[model samples]
Target: MTSPAELLALYDSQQRLVVPEHPPAGVTFEVTDGVMRVTGRGEGFVETTQHLGLSGGELDALIAKHRDHFAARGEAVEWKTRAHDLPADIPQRLERTGFEAQEKEAVLVGHTSDLLVARPLPAGVVIRETNDHNDIVGLSTMLSEVWNDDLSWLIEQLEAQLAAAPELTVLFVAEAEGTIVSGARIEFTPGSDFAGLWGGSTAPAWQGKGIYGALAAARAQRAQQRGVRFLQVDASPESSPILQRRGFVEITSTTPYIWSPSAPLGTQS
Candidate 1:
């Protein structure tokens, strides 16, 4: 297991810092006053500064700067603040500035060995790992159906990431008659104890058939194969209990603080 500070650093350096999609031309990134601001004409987001030591007033000034940018563009922004962020009172400031809280995800961390790897798949579903485009596209489409979003860009991003880091990522699909019905991806964070289970889902009709469990098992098995010791996920409500049943413990709760011009800027000083 990684130390809490090392785990935090891993998340900061390897995950949160990645801008998966290139923001538009006007969109920009900066770190000022202990805040990381991603601003653009129509959309923006802010996060606690990266590993920098700052006083409370500096952090507030950072938030204030982002607020000003969004005010000018009339855009909505999301602030991703972790529980470990010093001065937990930061969220209080955001609330004063019109950012409303949303669902908090359970951050589940478990040893890869803790995962039970024998869940049976649905009657007609079979699991497979693929480097083929057709298989990846099918998996992407199934995820889009489950998440109810246009996930073409997600597909592209995953493919690109896999191509760049082939040995560190695994994309698995549960297919029936050549059509994907469930899927997930496991991304290995090299030189670290952690591997991530991302984008897990099953088709509506395929739910409760143990497909999710099987897919999760497959990901865990692969993580173990890669010598990874820990598996972590920011699990949604539906998956959290199931993961708990599988012996994964919920460690922390994380919620994204979304700020939007569409929302009321209540009580801002």
Candidate 2:
């Protein structure tokens, strides 16, 4: 069994403070003072080093600067901070600077081999990899129906990602009788030992049928084939429990502090 401390250490050392190997077209990246900013996709994000030794004033200054960076582009932004990150007041500072906290997720880490064992899926449910335009659009439509949100944006994003590097992102869908019941994807960070599992939502009728776990196992199998050491998930409350039962360890917690121009200034202030 891997300790949470060791998993976190491995994650911080390899995943953080590294620039992307192949940035997609029209997407740009910048790193300064141990903070990395990704922009030019209409929605930008900020990722940081594991530790920052800034004082209160310095922290506030850093937040305001990145906040302005996105504001100038007329784009929304997300700042990802982990619970174990230093300067515990990071979230407070972000809120004070007009960022609103979104969903809280468990930082789940587990060895891929632990999940490689076979998982049985319900009859009539077939899991398959999809990158075709029509299939991608169908999968996006299915996800929007599952979440009751307009997630059409995913269509273009997924297309761009596949176009840029097919090896980095893989999308899988659970199909039943020609209808898309569930969709999910695994993302491998370039040159890293970890891969991320994202977007495993099933249709209302498809929930509780073991499809999600099957998708996870499939993704983990792919990760193992790629020589990945661990699989990571920023799991929601609903998913955290399920993943926890499957040998995944909760190393820490993370919440995205997001800011949008359409929203008010100081929404969290």
Winner by TM-score = 2
Give the residue spans of candidate 1 off by over 4 A.
1-57, 64-77, 260-268
Model 2 agreement with the true structure over 134-160: per-residue lDDT tens digits:
878888898888779998988887888
After superposing candidate 2 on the true structure, give the runs of residues whose Cα lies further than 4 Å from its correct spot. Answer: 267-269
lDDT of 1 by residue, 1-269 (tens): 55555656666665554443433344467765556677653457777644446446665665667777887887778888767666777778778777888788887877787774766766778998876788888877887887788776555656666776678778888898878898888877556667889888888988888888888888888887788878888899999998888777765567888777777765644
- After TM-score superposition, the amount by which residue 216's alpha carbon in candidate 1 deviates from its true location, in angstroms, is 1.3
Q: What is the TM-score of each candidate against the true structure?
A: 0.75, 0.94
What TM-score would you give candidate 1 relative to the actual structure?
Answer: 0.75
Q: How many clashing pairs per prediction, in order?
A: 2, 0
Clashing pairs in 2: none
On lDDT, the candidate that comes out on top is 2
Model 1, CA-based lDDT: 0.74
